[model samples]
Target: MYLVYYSVEISNLSENKQLSCFMHLQVPQTPTVIPQELNSATSTSIAVYWAVNDGDAIDCFQVYCMEELQASKDAGALVEEYRVTVKESHCILEDLEPDRCYSVWVMAVNGTGCSLPSEKAIFKTAPAIPTINAEDCTVCWDTATVRWHTSSASAESFTLEYCRQHSPEGEGLRSFAGIKRPELKVSLEPNVNYFFYLRTVNPFGTSEQSEAALISTKGTRFHLLSDTAHPALQISSKATVIHLPEKTKFTGFPSVLGELLPARGCHYWEIIVSACRSYRIGICYEAISQSSVLGLSDTSWCMRCCPTQTSSLYRFLHTGVMSDVCVTEHPARIGILLDYSGGRLLFFNAERGLVLFSIRHKFTDAAHPAFALEKAGVLTLRTGMELPEFVKHS
Candidate 1:
């Protein structure tokens, strides 16, 4: 039957009015990955280096010595044919000298073979700076303990001093000269904060002074704590002084011993003023220790001292980069001296592992505590027997 030919045909004539489901897909966000510096060193006629974050399919490594790199001959040569697979993060260059400087870099040899150099590092044998064995102190209490080794047994005596800032000239804060003993125990104050320093005095003008040790009066006390590390530390020649490119902060204190260099394109890096002592200044990535990378990040930091070949006259810095401030004028250096209880001096390097100097407890009483990183996030103090309280910060 021709029943109502009017078939109710719901024709899908709807073109744009269709209820379409869609997923707003977005790309994944990648983390901010900064290039990490490789830690390298020469051990027992072998050059040992390590990579932090190695990607997949590492093909081979490229080794360049100082000569190939056209660097200083004193810097030595780069290890060649040091190619190896990325089975592990660490790599080694056999048959290296203990008394030579080397620059080693790595390249990821992928399926396409070698890639560009990942990161370049500078390393040298012979300790970075002269270090001491058992160096320690107490804060807020008067007294410091210093021990040292001689490049030559004829090192004669040592010079000790304590001040609030680094001394550019050989003469630094509250100078104590020609002490025949390797260790010195001096009395400090209870109300003033002090920075203790030491230097090896020989026929030559005293080796660069040790980094300033930050201590406070009436802070932490020192008691006989268990010795964690060995007492002996290496001491070396005065390292090259690195001048920060940035001008001194308006709140920074000047060195009474020497004048500051003109600030240019500088920030901060770490260098060893001595074995157990290090200084802060505007160090560059090129001047990092080959042993450790402690506080180094993508951000730049200025270091005053470490083990390098910086001369004395050009060593002192008059300016510094303070947080949110620029120190044009120098501040007064007035602080009390005391012993540190149980604190270690830590330095940041790009190439080296984190370098540390242990100062033995010098107090007859309990061990006192030292507090750093209070100032605009810098290694404020280096060598001290005590930790001071109530710092007269400028």
Candidate 2:
């Protein structure tokens, strides 16, 4: 054939393609500027952004990410490597560990080869969800102290969320944010069941909500049942107080029963008596008739106060039998303590810290707090009270 291949010249090929033909194609220039949007990062993913050099030809981009080593010497043991290929200038590295430091770099790639990796971009993913330390959480009548723990060393802050357990979702849900420590104290309603959870936050974003925990605040909470009250008894709108008008034609005892009862655990409440001449405050079986005088039936026990001009006379009564109790002063405030498991009932002069009377009886039936006003007076009920230390010891 006469050596015709010697004279042919190809000028249409680009410099890079020519270099590739000669096996000397230059790699794309390394990405010079990589800007990290910290807010775009999440617990398990990170977004990386870089700029491609305008003068170099690029086909695809390669992203390399790895967990940063705490010690340089042990880099090979603990490091986890991740790589991805993309046609765009940005990529989201997925399935990364939460709350961990990572080093990332980008390389412009072409048919020839990949460029050197860009300067390492170091960042930390958002913190992981926190766990509520149930054993460390404590609740009282009106407040709760909650504690939590996290595995994330990068946790910047914490948030606590709570709501009444019975309330609808998002209703009455409250949050405490920007808590630097893993603990928080929240004010809450007494004797209410509440649901709680925790979340961790970093500069990147907030973690997912932790598993929820349920707790009930301590103390007894109840109100007078209007349906169980005598017709003449004037019950307050909130049903926390009852009044017997000085003039009324009702014939039966002005009595009422509390709306709730404690079948277990020790419970306490208070009653404010406003200048009453005669009244009966006690606990009785819920089946007790509203017309029956409190303390006069076998199902009830009470402390009856009948004050004379000279002094206040008190008596402990049950099943129509009564015993006189000596008192040094009139009591305007009375405290009632009932320990169902212990089978103990006690009445206290709340202001004087004097034990007015006590009875030990195995409660065979569900008991409701009962009140009766023999004469015109106001009786305000106060529930959700913590048991006194003296009562606990007694």
Candidate 3:
């Protein structure tokens, strides 16, 4: 079968006898030229534009070298041979080498295929920002600490500030001077999370904060339970079972279908101690399963280790087993982890609640249902018959 495509035909009226119809009429894409005045680059602004012609439905857009566009000046480069997209057209490309020519263009694509490249445009990138490196944080505490860093050499001096991020709205509420050694130390809390902002000081004013980043101080050594599955949380086999002080709470209900369950329905057990010197808590079990194991009828409900005063209480409304241990140490931040092989394991965090940051891990066999509390402290195993490997508390 032969394929035929019809082009738009136009005839002028009042031409007398009859309007002559021309075949093989060529219709070009709308705009043949795009005009944009290059503006001064700043800490925040960048250039962005839409480059499509003839009202064609676009599939995707691309940016390519202008030289290629000039080589095929008639149309433009094909869809493939390019780099980068206008993903964030307003994205500020930092750390550019001074006085360099950069060419950028956008191409539109449709069902017919990729459209001709847009008009080629060239712009020079600004000079690189002066070099400067901040000092790593030294001292830390439960709440905050002091931090310092060097100023950019090219700058006469630098200004120091910090915020959760680098936006006009996020600009530092506070700023400090850095005139000597290019160093300045700011105070911070031990475990508190924060963001540090740095800028170069020239007569032109402060360059934007290098980049927005999140920084958390090291208050105490904690283990991470890694599992990306939703509503799933896991812990290293080495968390101590300390009694959360009275009034301790957990954030969310560790549920399978995202519902919190009754606290009284769950059993509460604490690690027993021969003496009173154990820092870590311990428990006894062959393996955690989805079935009638660990006295849990719901296979989805697994064991969770929670800190006494942490925000986890805000995530889940239900309470866990209120063992005497919770009345004792009252650890503030607790870690949740599990190994569910025959069944599934679901863990939740306070901020995310029934979602985000949950981890789950499945195991084939129960090698170590019982773990030695390496991080928390030592304790006597409670809740199961016949301790497997009992370690005496001093």
lDDT of 2 at 255: 88
Index of the highest-lDDT prediction: 2
Summarize candidate 1's per-residue lDDT along 1-394 as a digit string, tens digits. Answer: 1111222433475764544444232221211112223223322222434543323344344444431333434455544543444443445554544334455565544344444564555554322223543324322234434445545343556776766443357764687786887666666644455566666544422345566555555343232222210122111122122222233353323211111111211111122332222333331222222222222422223323323343211122223322222223222121212222322122232233322221222223221111111112222223322222122110
Superposed Cα deviation of residue 293, candidate 2 (Å): 42
Task: Candidate 2: give the clashing pairs.
Answer: none
Give model 3's TM-score versus the native structure. 0.25
Which model scores highest in TM-score? 2
Ranking by lDDT: 2, 1, 3
- Candidate 2 lDDT tens digits, 134-185: 5455444456668888998878899899888889766876898899998887
Off by over 4 Å in 2: 1-27, 33-35, 55-57, 71-78, 169-172, 218-394
RMSD of every candidate to native, in Å, equals 28.6, 16.2, 22.4
Q: What TM-score against the true fold does each predicted structure earn?
A: 0.24, 0.50, 0.25
Tens digits of per-residue lDDT, candidate 3, 1-394, equal 1122555434555545454443342222422224333434433322445534444444455555322233324674453333555442223333333333445565554444554666666644332233322223322222222333433333545555655433366454576665444445455543345565556554323455554334444322221112210132223243322222233243432111111111111111223432322222212233333222221322222333444453222122112332221223333322222323223222222122222122232333322222222122323322211111111100
Off by over 4 Å in 3: 1-47, 51-54, 65-81, 84-100, 111-116, 124-130, 133-172, 175-196, 200-394
Clashes of 1: 117
